[model samples]
Each structure stands twice: as C-alpha cells, then as structure tokens.
Target: MPTLDPTQLETLVVIAEEGTFDAAARRLHITPSAVSQRIRALERAAGQVLVRRTTPCTPTEAGEPLIRQGRQLRLLLAEAAATLKTGDTDDTVVDLSVVVNADTLATWFRPVLDEVATWDRTALRITVEDQGYSADALRRGEVLAAVTSEPKPVQGCTVEPLGRLRYTPGATPALVERYRKGRGIDWSAMPMIVYNEKDHLQDEVLAAHRATRPPVVHRVPSSHDFHEAIRRGLGWGMLLDAQAEADLASRTTIPLPGAKPIDIQLFWQRWRLDSIALDDLSEAVRRAARSGLRPTRPL
Candidate 1:
C-alpha cells in the first residue's frame, strides 16, 4: 500500500482550503516554492494528478480521500488535546463548515445553532445554497455536512429525514385584489417574486394551478428582502409557513386559493464518522427540526 507523507497531505488540504500555493504557504508559514515541492512529491507518490491547476485550485478524484484524511487527523488531534487537558488553546477549536438553504437559515436554523454555541470548543462556518443543490457541496467536499432536499446520501455521508417545510402561495392584499378583479389570475402576465434564478417554487405553484405561461419573475436573492418585496406588493410568491406567520396575522398577505402548498422534505447529510462534535451538532439539529417542522411522512 502506498503511504502518504503527513506534511504533504496537510499541504494538499491547506491548498484546497486556501485555493493557491502562495496562500497555503502563508498559512503554513513556509515558502511558496516549498509548498509546490511538497505537492509535487505527494503527486509522484500517489502516481496521479492530485490537484487540478486551476485559477482557484481544486482537488482531483485522487486527492479527495487524502483531503478527508487530513481533516480527520485534525479532528482526532483536537479530540486528543481535549482529552489530555494539554496546553491546547482556542487555535485547537474545530471549524465545522456546513451548507444550508436560505429559508432554513432565516427561520429554524438559527435556534439550532444556539445549541452548537454551547460547545465552546467548536466554531461553525456556514455556506448558504439552495436546498436542491446543497448536496452537491457535500459531494465536492466543500462542507462537512448539509441540509439538503435529496434523500439519497452522498458517497460517504449518512442521511436522515429532518422534516418538511411548507410553502404557501402568498400575495399582498393589493395583488390579491388585482388577481380577484380578473376572471382568474393571469399568472403568466402577473409579476412574481422569486429567490433567484435557481428558485423553482413559483413555477411549481403556477404549474399546479395549470397556468401554462411563465411569469415575469422578480429576483430577490436575500431572504429578508424576498419577503419584504412580496409584503410591499412587488410580486406574488410562495412564503414559508414561519415567514407567512406575521403576514397571515396582519392580513398583509393572503394565500391564493386552488393551490396546494409546496411541502419540501429536508434531510440531514453528514459524514458517517464518530466525531463527538459532529454527533452532538447533528442531534441538536435533529431535535430542533423535530420541534419546528412537520414530521416526515412514510412513502
């Protein structure tokens, strides 16, 4: 079996995180030339092009396992330090990078993170992506875990049902008035709000209503702004139930009739490892989801 040099493996992981040889060298407190040499030697030992020479460098298929190994080693070292009561400082804190969707970030995800705050030895680095594409971040090794809509686990990750987030078609009273004035909502001609180009909820709602044409979508990427846009009558869009709470009570927004709300089933995807921090964080998230979301229904 081929053995990887520890220094070379660490170099690969740092380069992947820092995105360039110079940046990796700066992080490791070495010359950029030394970083290059270490990577070259590592590639020779592996007998493959481990790192793709891109603008912001990325790992090849052969490099992923080594990168993961490097991460695992760091975690183990942190665990050992914590166990030994050694002179480990805050520098030993584990940084857990996770990907989550915008809606979750705005609503239920915050309270879950409060649990993570109790772990003084760990810090979370969060990446926001659409629920539909979050698993791709995990597959690419960009994050340690993710909240994704996909039930299928990524290559080395374990997946479990979190719960469902319901989204209802919502519009301002003014927009509703306009919609009701017509014989029916001319959805194709009406202005609509969407999170971004990647958002499909609006189109799905339109399809469910049998509206054949696409609307003039107003893209509001920020979650707060997206809600505000609809609240201010920019366009009609689906609002997550939690978000719709205030609007529903105030009668500022009304649900469009004849359309069933979209219930997005979410799942937790994380590495199938026995790290204490990961385990604790996952349990906290699961607990929060159980309390905040609808239970996942059996198919």
Candidate 2:
C-alpha cells in the first residue's frame, strides 16, 4: 500500500482552492517550486496526474477523491484544534462552503443568511448554481453542501428531500395579447425568456404545447432579472409561484393559458461529516424549506 503524505495532501488541497501554483504558494507561505515538488511527489505516490495544468488549475478525475479526502482531513484537524484549545477566545474559524440555486437564493434561502449571520466563528462561502447541476460541485468537493434537484446523494454525502419549488408560465398582459392566436396565445410566435442554456422550464412548457422554440429566445441568467424580463415584456418566462401570484394579483403578468405549473423537487445534500457546523446548517435549511417550499408528495 502506498502511503499518502499529509503535507502533500494539504498542498494539493491548497492548490485546488487557490486555482494556481503561485496562488497556493502565497497562501501556504512557500515558494512556487516547493508547491510543485509536493504535487509531483503526490502524483508519483498515486501513479496518476493529479492537478490539471490550466490557467485556474483544476483537479483531474483521479485527483477528486484525494481533494475530498484532504478537505475532510483539514476540517477534522480544525475541529480538533478548536476543541483542544484552552483559551477563552479561541479564534478558529471553520470555513463552510455551500452551493445553492439562484432561484432559491432569491426566494426561500434568504433565512439561511440570517441564521449564518449569527455564527461569528464560521466563514461562509456560497456558490450560485442551478439546482439541477449543483451536485457537480459536491462531486468535485468544491462545496460542503448543496441545495440540488438531484435526489440521489453524491458518494460520501447524505441527501434529504427539501420540498418542491413550483413555477408557473407567465407573461406580461401586453405580450400575451400581442401573441394571442384566436383563443390561446401563440406559443410558436411569442418570444421567450430562459434562465440559461441549462434552464429547461420554458422548453418543458413549449413541449407541452407541442410547439418549437421561437426565433427570439432571450437568456436572462439571473433569477430576479429573469422575473423582471417577463414583467417588463422582454419575453415570456417561467416565474416562481410566489412571484407569479403577486404579479397576477397586481395585474402585471398573467399565467399562460393551458400551461401547467412546473414543480422541481429539491434536496439538501451534504458531506457525511460528524461536524456540528454542518448539522446546524442542515437544520436551518430544513426549517427554511418547510416555511417557504411546498411539501413534496411521495412519487
């Protein structure tokens, strides 16, 4: 069995976090040559190239497991040190990295910020990713936890259903009238707005209507902007149920006729670590989800 050096593993973790050999060296207070030596020695032990030589260095497929291991080890060490410290003012701050979808951030995930704000000794790092793709961040060990649409947990992680985020196809009243085809709006002729290429809600609506995408498909990546685009008549797009209902009551936007609501089931996935920070975060997330999201029914 080949022995992996703790120092080398930590060096690789720093490199992965810093995104460059020089940056990692600066963080570690070591020379770039020294950083290179540690990585080279690690790769030799593993018999596989670990870090990809890119502008923002990334871990190769073979390196992902090691990166995760290194992070876990570092987390444990930090916790242990904090526990062992005898001082009344132990200043060990645990870095907690989490990924959340933009829509959730704009909606139900706000309370999480409030909860985290009270934790003086925890450093929070948040990555905005689409719920459907957030699991990729977890798989790569880029985040400790994620609010993801994927029901299955990543290896070494635990998953629990958070609930479903409901979306309704909506458009400005003027836009809908302009594209009205007799009794129903012309799905093929109307311009559409999508969150991004990864967004499929608009496509799902179109598929339901048996229509192809219109020539003018505007991509508004931001959740708030996407909702505003629909409101300002840029193009029709799906809006969160809360957003749509408010607009509907205000007579700013109307739900698309014959379009059914889209419900995306969300799950909370976190590394299976025996850490109080992670557990507290998970509880907070669950509470927020319960308050803001619709309960998911058994399939």
Candidate 3:
C-alpha cells in the first residue's frame, strides 16, 4: 500500500480547487515550482496521474477518492481546532459546499438560506444542478451534499427522503387557447419550455399524453426565468405546484385540462461525516422540506 503524505494530498486538493499550479502555490504560500514538485512526488507515490492539466485543473478518476479524503481531513481538522480553542476568539470558517436543484433553490430551500445566515464562521457554496443529476456532483466530490431524486445513496453518503415536489403542466391562458384544437389543447402542436437539456418534466408530461415534443422548444435554464417565460406566454412547461397555483389564481396561467400532476420524490444525500456544520445544514434542509414539500410517499 502506498503511503500518502498529508501535505501532498492537501496540495493536490488545493490545485484542483484553484484550477492552476500557480494559483495553488499562491494559496498555499509556496512557489509554483514547489507545487509542481509536490504533485510530481505525489503522483510517483500513487503510481498514477492524479490530475488532468487542463485550463482548469481537474482530478482524474483515480484522484477523486484522494480529493474526497483531503476535503474530509481538512473539515475534521478545522472542527477539532475549533473545539480545542473554544472561546479563544479564533474564528474558524468552514466552507459548506452543497448542490441543489434550481427549483428547490427558488422555492422551499430559501428557508435554509435564512438558517445558514445566522451561523457564525460558515461559508455556503451552492452549485445549482438538476435534481436528477445532482448526485453526480456528490460522486465527483464537487459538493458535500445534494438535493437529488436518486433514492440510492452515493458511496460514502447517506440518503434520506426530503419529500416530493409536485409539478403541474401549465401554460399562459392565451397560449393555451391558441393551441386549442376543438375541446382539447394540442399537445403535439403547442410550444414547450424546459429548464435545460437535463430537465425532463416537460418531456415526461408529453410522454404521458402520448405526444412528442413540438419543434419550437424554448430553453430557459434559470428557475425564475423559466417561470417568467411561462408567464410571458413563451411556452407551456411543468411548474412547481406553488408557482402554478399562484399563476392560476391570477389568471396568468392555466393547467392543461386532463393533465395529471407529476410528483418528483426528492432525497437529501450528504457525505457520511461527523461534522457539526454538515449536521446543522441537514437539519435546516429537513425542516424546510417538511414545511414546503408534500409528505414522502411511494412515487
């Protein structure tokens, strides 16, 4: 078994985060040559290339476990130092990286922000990803936690149901009427909107109706922008129940007649670590989900 040096592992993690050897050197307060030497020594010890020398350096597949290990080590050390120096005015800031779906960010997840805002010496780094794919960020060690649709836990992580986010297929009243064919809306001819290529809610609705996506598909990636696009009559799209209800009440949007609501069961997946910061965040997340999302049930 190869023995990994703590300093070299930390340097490799820093390089991956900083995206360049020079940047890592600056961050570590060492010379770029020193950074290169450490990386070389580490790679030699491991007998594999740990990082890809790209525009922004990325850990190779073989390096992911080490990267995760480095981050976990750093977090534990920070926590231990903070514990040992209790009330000594040594404010140790811990970075909490989490990946969340855009819809959750715009909706129920707002409360988590309020909770995190009150914490001392904590920095929140949120990566917006689609729910279906957010777990991939966890697998790549890009985030410490994720709001995902995957029920299975990623390796080294634990999964808990966060409840379901219900979506209604809706469109502007005018857009709905424009595509109406006799007593029914033309599912095949109506224009559609999607948050991104990863978003499948609209497609799922179409499939349920035995219809294919129309040619005039509009991509509005931002959650707020996607909602606004629907409000502006750009196209029909699946919207969160809260968003749909408000729009429907205001006569701005209407649910497609006979369209069944889609409920996506969400889960909270986090690294299995004994970090206080992570525990605080998980509690906040669970609380917010309970308040905003429907109760978890078989999907």
Best by TM-score: 2
Model 3 has an lDDT value of 0.91
Candidate 2, 117-178: lDDT as tens digits:
99867888999998889999999988889999999889999999999999989998899899
List the candidate 2 regions with Cα displacement exceeding 4 Å.
Answer: 86-89
Order of the predicted models by TM-score, top scorer first: 2, 3, 1
Instruction: Please give me the total number of clashing residue pairs in predicted model 2.
Output: 0
Model 1 clashes, total count? 0
Tens digits of per-residue lDDT for model 3, 50-78: 99999899999999988888888877777
Q: Against the unseen true structure, what C-alpha lDDT does each candidate score?
A: 0.86, 0.91, 0.91
Winner on TM-score (2 vs 3): 2
Prediction-by-prediction clash tally: 0, 0, 0
Off by over 4 Å in 3: 86-91
Q: List the residue pairs that clash in candidate 2.
A: none
Error of 2 at 18 (Å): 1.8
lDDT tens per residue, model 1, 43-123: 999999999989799999988878877776776667667767656553567878899999999988887788888877787
RMSD of 1: 1.8
Task: Judging by TM-score, tell me the better candidate of 1 and 3.
Answer: 3
